[model samples]
Target chain A: MKQRLSTLMAAAVMTAAFAVQAQQPMKKAPPPAKAAAPAKAKDGITAEFEKFREVLEEDNPAELFEAKGEDIWKHKKGPDGASMAQCDLGLGAGVVKGAYVQMPRYFADVGQVMDAERRIVHCMVKYLGYKEEDIRKQPFSNDSKTPDHVSVITYVAAQSRNMKIAVPQKHPKEIETFRIGREIFDYRAGPYDFSCATCHGSDGMRIRTQDLPNLRKPAEAIRAYQGWPGYRMTGGFMLTQQWRMNDCFRQQRFPEPAYLSDSITALLTYMTATANGQVYKGPGIKR
Target chain B: MTAMKTTILCAATLACGAALAEEVRDYRAEAIAMMKRDFKTRGIATADRVHEDGLQAICNRTSDHPPKAIAERLERDQMESIKYPPDGKLMGDWKAGEKLAQSGRGMTWSDKAGVPGGGNCYNCHQIGPQETSFGTIGPSLYQFGKLRGNTPDVQKYAYGKIYNAKAFNLCSAMPRFGHAGALTESQIKDLVALLLDPQSPVNSK
Candidate 1:
């Protein structure tokens, strides 16, 4: 009882601090002309941002969620009284090593290609007896709270650190899913006529100093794959690739995709397959 | 006998063409169907946003580079849609334009309806040198007025370009601010002044 109370109190204080930081605008820096070194590939600001990220990565808060997720994965508290230890993640039951890097793959039992988060949610629904709709109600974490599944995903992703991305292409369905994902990436609509391609289809593009990776290219595609299931510093929330895709649609001025839907899975398959053979650098810290 | 042989050859070629066409999967149609099934309209974002316009369909089909004749024809249609501000004034306050260029707000599911949208010019272009964090997706617009003399033609071009960038170049990465009902005519005029006004910081050394 005492431990729970202290944990709750710590969470409250952290949420307050995050709220304050969220409202504060980004600090303005001096013009680049004064600090401009002899022209290099990267500008001064991007270089500075990179150095800052390296410093932050040393003490990433995603570890907090990973610990919490590990706890949830072990405990058997659901209505079905089953732990997620036996959940099959495309590598047979009870197996977790390097599972994340090969996912968005065909699961014969479910007969659908499920990404890491989607398969995690599926396990939660099938083995743990949680209602899918209830889980979907607030799948993403916010300033005040982080979902259990989000933490689980963080924990799962950490297991695949330093592993090569090898999203499967053996299944005919897997190939079709990847093809559909590419089509979705290029499909343009909405108010701006913006597809994923509009911002990310080409190389050497930016949307205000922020580099937009061309996902079609393997070298740049790793930028999208790596550092996901990240701790976003601005909101102090642990987020997953699922949340990222949902937010992308929102920013694209399009309707929200149904949580853990096939479209998101297909999109992940496309991106992950393109990034095959690249190393994933575990849970990342985001600015 | 020669006529009969020619008829048989045509039939075989037609059969081969039909077989090749059938083998190709219509992944675009499947993707659209999946989106229709999986996406739910929320707030200001509606289901109709998934449906592509005719020009958008062409751009997607051709990878943003449609044929020359077709592109020119559609570009003219886009040009004819530009609505210049009343009172014969194409320039507004450059100060307002600067603010709009810096902002990246309005027009999402979260934004309230009827609020003014930002031009978001700096998100993809360098305008005033003071803001060093400008993007490189589009060409730099620094000294837009200094390089091009601020003639009536220049002012009109700036206004029209912001109003509907597709009018100038089809398949441009730049959005059509006015044509899409995103920015008001008055807002586009301010952006014009920001580009062409001599007193604006964009023109100043």
Candidate 2:
């Protein structure tokens, strides 16, 4: 009778252990929908910066890209003849809105971390069977040209506009990725021996009249991260954060970071977490 | 009794998780290694360019605010590295200098080697009065010669500062145009003249 009791206890404990292991991969419950933060007195918003925000709100050029992106997201064309309607964007299949802020998070199936753009490209390749090389060639848009990748990112980011950033760091990989990103931010290299930290690590530092955001802190991180997928008034292009990272590397005199590579995704993960809880106010306009 | 035991077991598991969370994960070394794997050499931009020199490493390590004594020592070393022109003429044509200040084209990966690089002064300073668009990274040099008299010492100071800004302030964000070999001695002399020459728009009304 004692032996029977021991066997029954063992079976119950094993079931409990399995349950805990299974729960690890389950997504966190979606938080209550947050209202956009009231625009506090635009302290430090330069006259030009403020002017750009005020004037461009109604007729923001990013809308054009978003429209194009929506079309491409639904269109079927690649080898598999599959539309990206069911791309799993951390919030189950085909559900688009409010998912952007949580991305650059771990995707278990891919066995890697992926940002919004990287995930989009993965869906493109996996579902549509498009060549990675062909897709990456013109990831950005020009004055007269709109590329699928650039427009799609803008569209996805807009869906999450004003949502609170909530990139998860529950997984061990996610925790380690944040450390990896911190180091990358400070890593100094190149002919100029410049790092991203050189320009951005310090507060009150300006490149020109433009104020540099010190991304180490949460407040500044939110301000900087939320402003991308922006329409550049000067460049006349809808630029995403990935393009911004690429350009910064170029200016630092470092060689180009591979497209959608782990390094870039890690950097994104770090920024996304740093930007947590801030209402995204992008599809923004920039000088 | 079994329910109580299971509850205690769960509590113990939670404690183990808390302990594991306490483990520190430092990313500095891994990030450095990742860059080594990720960066590819293209054009004039080589892989070795990532290696920080002694001075750069110092500024980086200290967060651009080195100790006063160390900064002074390093500034002195930087000052010693400057090679004055053989003829002892520090001033060059303000016209050429003004042109050089206006252009910011140089040292980019796509830029051809052996080509003359710009002073890029306008990108960081207000030089010519006619050019309303200017970057404010460095202080305004409008009336530079007018504010500080254009004496021989002043001429030498401007020349030296343009050649190696780190020699003056050890961690100034201004690039070492001369030290980095991005600009020639003649180009730097022209920049000095642009700032110190009374005839230049920087000093003129």
Candidate 3:
């Protein structure tokens, strides 16, 4: 009788184990079921993009701008007879490599945090002695063949290609700046009452043919953060991060953001830090 | 009898008048003439911009949606115009791609010739989360690789999209970066990495 009881107890224990295993959620979901095969000619959106890729393989006009920017980088300018070579981009003075990947850092000399465009503008004014108005007033070139400051920024950004983004977040100021940036990111206002999160902050969203990235996610943050200072196809110009931000304000119908204002710098720090460890790729091309 | 004859004559006259009004006029020519007469060419915006290419003409005529067969044929023609890298390399540094995506400069009337242009991706896309300010013309690309997976096929798709958006959609609002010579091969490659590289922020943990 005792032996019989032991067998029954063992069976009950085995049943309990099976029930527990069944109740637990699987670590990963099964792969999606295959549906009716799509046409080979219509490989969804992927095939379409492949066609676009083939076209871009030819000569790019941005190369000319990059070449010109290189010249400007090494060229002597300003009343001080100094070149941007002496300018520091948070990686020490005269260092252009990988500087673009990490930006909006704190600088004691500047006494405040600054982004790439603001830093460049400061260098131009303080180091080069170019009038701020002159630099700001110089309109973008009309011709497709001209190079400008935007190109210079692009060239510089390209130098840091493939490097990891490491925007410092250890400083108190950096932390404060990031907090403010977060507020701005989530702040909802404007005619449409739109916030940055309205368009982003979610997954599987799209506008027309383009996909929207969820900025809250680290992977998306890095991919989006690193590709600034790019060449634009619509406006037919190269633009810096500052200009991009400024335009965003305009679209939102908000007052123009002060060029390189602490708000802007803080935003940059927040983005760069959020994107931590992602490879940098800038001086990119955009539609 | 005289009253009926007069009524028939009036009806014939009205038909002839309607036929005359129905004749199609060359509105394009007239518009061109008006533009040439009234519009002044400035520093960089030349009068030639008024002219449309064959594709543009078709798009204009069809209002962005043409017959499927015609669109396919035109797309094929457009594909013919694409230029691949000589070395067949299509990937560049994602770091560089990031900077390019952020910039919005170049090709303004005030700009000089021979300068580079900005991609202005943010004008249409929401790429990075840190950019509190961005546009909504294109879709956001925050976690492209996390959802899509970083495969060679995905990389190729991204490269192509950056190079020529139209190749994928006949009426895509996204500009044809490569088809129009706006972006270099290396630049496109870098952008590819920005979207597809596992180490890229798009795929980061």
The candidate maximizing TM-score is 1
Error of 2 at A210 (Å): 3.2
Order the candidates by lDDT, highest first — what do you get?
1, 2, 3
- lDDT of candidate 1 over A1-287, digit per residue (tens): 45654664465355446546545665556665432222223445456546756765655678778878878887756775777877999887867889999998999998889999999989878877878888888899997899888988998999999999989999989998999999999998888878998888898787776878999999998998889998876677898999899989988878889999999999999999999999999999765
Clash pairs, candidate 1, are none
Which of the two, 1 or 2, has more lDDT?
1
How well is each residue in B1-205 modelled by candidate 1, as lDDT tens digits?
5445555565778575554443556889999999999988888788888888888888888888899999999999999988876688999999999999998776678877877878888888888867767777788898899899789899989989988888888888777888888898888889988999999888886
Q: Model 2 over residues B1-205: C-alpha lDDT tens digits?
A: 5445555565768565554444333366677677777766667766666666778777866777899999999999999999889999988889899888977767767667899878777665766665544565677787789899899999989988888888999877777888888888898888888888888777765
Candidate with maximal DockQ: 1
TM-score of chain A of 1: 0.87
| Candidate 3, superposed: residue stretches over 4 Å from native | A1-50, A53-60, A138-147, B1-205
Q: Write the per-residue lDDT of candidate 3 for residues A170-275, one digit (tens) a residue.
A: 7666666666666555443322223455556567555423456777777988756644665444444566667666555444333344455666676667767788
CA deviation > 4 Å runs, candidate 2: A1-56, A59-61, A75-86, A232-237, B1-26, B67-73, B126-132
DockQ of each model against the real complex? 0.51, 0.19, 0.02
User: Per-residue CA lDDT of candidate 2, range A228-249, in tens?
Assistant: 8987654466888888888777
Error of 2 at B105 (Å): 2.4
Candidate 2 positional error at A287, Å? 4.9
